[model samples]
Target: MLLHASFPFLKEASYLASIYPQIYLDFGLRIPKPNFHGLMSSVKEILDLAPINEVMINSSGITFAE
Candidate 1:
């Protein structure tokens, strides 16, 4: 399943994805809207818990001008 704005629930989401192969995470929408530092921190948090293959990068609603 594609999850949106999953930063705050990274731990839970990661655990779910790790045990259930059907679950997948997307770092979209909410991730890209934040500043670079915040984005990196969020991504790091998610990565720390979830496997790399289980997570996908999304640039939705993101603009270079931001």
Candidate 2:
């Protein structure tokens, strides 16, 4: 499932994904919007609860300008 920017829901999402083999997480808008530390912390939180393979990187269709 594609999750959006909901910091508080991180734990729940992780827990659910861990139990449900079909459930997946997308680190899209949530990652880029946070500060460096916040981003790292968020990723750590997810990793602590879910397996690495269950997570997926989402670009959110956003491109950076040079």
Give Cα-based local distance difference scores for all models.
0.73, 0.76
Lowest lDDT 10-residue stretch of candidate 1: 27-36
TM-score per candidate, chains pooled: 0.73, 0.76
What candidate 2 gets wrong by more than 4 Å, as runs, is 31-33, 64-66
- Which one wins on TM-score? 2
For candidate 1, write residues 1-66 as lDDT tens digits: 657536578778877877888888887756443588877777777788778888987667566675
Candidate 2: the clashing residue pairs are none
Candidate 1: the clashing residue pairs are none
